[model samples]
Target: MTKTLTIRRPDDWHLHLRDGDMLRAVLPHTSRDFARAIIMPNLVPPVVTGDDARAYRDRIMAALPADHDFTPLMTLYLTENTDPDDVAAAHADGLIAAVKLYPAGATTNSASGVTDFTRVAPVLERMAQIGLPLCTHGEVTDPEIDIFDREAVFIDRVLDPMRRNHPGLRVVMEHITTSNAVDYVKAHDTGLAATITTHHLVINRNHILAGGIRPHYYCLPVAKRETHRLALRAAATSGDPRFFLGTDSAPHTDANKLLPCGCAGCFTAPNTLPILAEVFEQENALDRLEGFTSLNGPAFYGLPANDATLTLVRETPEIPAQIDTPEGPVTVFDPGMPLNWTV
Candidate 1:
């Protein structure tokens, strides 16, 4: 067995570092391994403009530890009223890396998301012209759609048509959770890709509901069946440039998560690297781990891979069950098995 593995430092293609105290506490976890991350824009008020994105980036920089060399790549939250000019200007100025599309009410703090796709057509057109990418929470929010079926339905009903309309637009189906998503991205030749989260690869729907309600495993575009989890594992380890790491390591205080109507997210930032190493090892695809976690994301985003490298030794370490923050305690995702790798 390969005992020690060294690869280019990875970048998290998608991440959520919430504001204020939460941000301060969680930022270090991600900075520890990832060289940079595409920061999510779905805060309470939401980051809908170049100015909002810039301010958020500044806050992230402020919260970052002085010794860390991590960069927070900003993104704008697309709204029905999003100005095409502002988006173009932000991308041109390098203030924002991409624009995030959250269908209104799709997930936490998504009330300000786009309710009318047509209203944002001009913005999408401008993005295509500028070669800016659109990162999406790819699920339809219709009340009638079975929660489990939303992702597949979104592809057939929303994503496919939108892609056909804007052939030049680059889109990332963020934190994709199903085989349908896997097949869809594979079938599309270019201008389309998907990010698979670390938590999704480890847990299936059963982990959330089988024995008892496990709030820590609950997240939007929730974990799918065992078969879907297997598919995601296969795609992520397949060495496909279109599939890459995006931890989507959202943090919610224990109070909020264990409530009657708990928030949706898994705080996986702290342990993602070790868990990933273990998963890749078990799949007997350790050779492809570098591409999946480190190389593929940068290749898809047209950015240079990190010059630095991270070394993971095959040594077991005990992972803490939870991390305490000023706001409250946040649970760490337990992969339900001991991890034998450490970075």
Candidate 2:
């Protein structure tokens, strides 16, 4: 059996580092492993303009530990009233990596998201003209649609139409959870890709509902059936450049997570690497781990692969039950099995 493996330091294609105290507590975990991360802009007010992205990037840099050498590749949260000029300038200045699209009410703090897709046509056109990528939350917020079916439905109802209209636009289907999403990406010849989260690769909907309501296991675009989990694992470990790692490691205090209507997210930043190593090892596809976690994302975003490397040793690493933050203790995601690799 292989004992030690080393790969280029990875980048997170999708990440949520909430502002203020939560940001201070959680930023270190990701910085320790990832060389750069596409920071999500769905804050309380949301980062909607070029100025907003720049200011948020400054806060991320201020919060990062002095010893950690990490870069925050920022993004602007797209809204109905968003200025296409601001987005274009941000990308032109290299101030932001992508523009995020969240359907209104789709997930946490998404009340400010786009309700009318057509209203954002000008922004999408400008993005296409400049080669900027649009990162989508990938779920429709229709109350009638079953949560489990939202992702697949979004492809048909929203995403396909948008792509068909703006053929030149590049899109990243963020934190995708189904085989339908996999097939969609495969069907597309170019200008389309998907990001698979570390948590989604391990847990299915049953993980959240089986014995009892496991709030820590619950997340937006909630984990799907076992077959879907298998498909995500296959795609992630397939060495396909179109699929890559995006640990949607969102943090919610234990207090809020256990509420009657708890928030949706899994705090997986700290242990993503070790768990990914175990999953790839089980599939006997360790050779492809580097591409999924490190290389593919940069290629899609037009950035260079990280020069430094991370080595994982074949030994179990202790995972804390929870991480204590000033606001409250945030539970870390448990893969529900022994992980034999540690970075």
Candidate 3:
């Protein structure tokens, strides 16, 4: 057996560290394993402006542990009324790494997202001109569309046309869950990429719907059929630069997740590295693990890979069933299988 493996420290291309007590409680889990992360901007009010992103970044820094060596690469949430010039300036000053696009009502805290895509054409054009990447939620909120089909439909109705209109715009299809998404990304040689999450690789729709309703297994861009899970695993382990790791480790308190209409997310931050190592080892592609979790993301974002290294030993890890927070207990994602790697 391959006993131990070391690679450059990974970066999360997509992450959600909710503000306040939740932020303080969860920030350490990610910083412990990752050297940096692209912090999601979908707070209740949303980080809409340069000032908002700056303030949010400051708060993230304040919440980070003093001894942890980690950086929060911030992003701004896109709204129809967003100021293109402000976004450009934020990138110029290195205040933000990217801009997030959430179609209104697509996911949690997304009410402030863009409802009218046309209204943001100017912003997209400006982003393309400056080579700023647009990280997208990749779902359409149309009530008529089947929930399982939202991602594929969004590509046809929203993403494709947007890309067609702004040829130079760089886009990251964050937390993609469908093979259609994989094909779309493959068709485009450049200016397009996709982020696959840890939970998605291990679970499918059955994990959430079978036997009983497993709330902890539920998440936005909900897991699809088994075939799609296989596709994601293939893409992530393929050593393809166009696909990379983005845990999308959204945390919701157990109270919030068990309600009649529970929130959608999987709190995978605590054990992502171990779970990823297990997945990569199973695929017999341990060689590509570094590219997925560490190198590809930085290259896609035009940043340098981390100099620090993380070593994973082949041993089972003790993962908590739940983590405590001020509001309530938040369940850590259970990969539902034994993980034999620990960092």
User: What C-alpha lDDT do the candidate models reach, one value each?
Assistant: 0.93, 0.95, 0.96
RMSD of 1: 0.7
TM-scores of the candidates are: 0.99, 0.99, 0.99
Q: Candidate 2, residues 1-343: lDDT per residue as tens digits?
A: 8999999999998999999999999999999999999999999899999999999999999999999999999999999999999999999999999999999999999999999999999999999999999999999999999999999999999999999999999999999999999999999979999999999999999989998999999999999999999999999999989999999999999999999999999999999999999999999999999999999999999999999999999999988889999999999999998999999
Residue pairs with backbone atoms closer than 3 Å in model 3 (clashes) = none
How should the candidates be ordered by lDDT, best one leading?
Answer: 3, 2, 1
Which of the two candidates, 1 or 2, achieves a greater lDDT against the reference?
2
Q: In candidate 1, which residue pairs clash?
A: none
Candidate 1 lDDT, 1-343, residue by residue in tens: 7889999999998999999999999999999889999999998889999999999999999999999999999999999999999999999999998999999899999999888899999999999999999999999999999999999999999999999999999999999999999999999889998999999999999999987999989999899999999999999999889999999999999999999999999998889999999899889999999999999999888999999999999899667789899999999988998899999
Model 3, residue 180: displacement in angstroms?
0.2
Residue-level lDDT of model 3, residues 51-151, one tens digit each, is: 99999999999999999999999999999999999999999999999999999999999999999999999999999999999999999999999999999
Candidate 3 ranges with C-alpha deviation above 4 Å: none
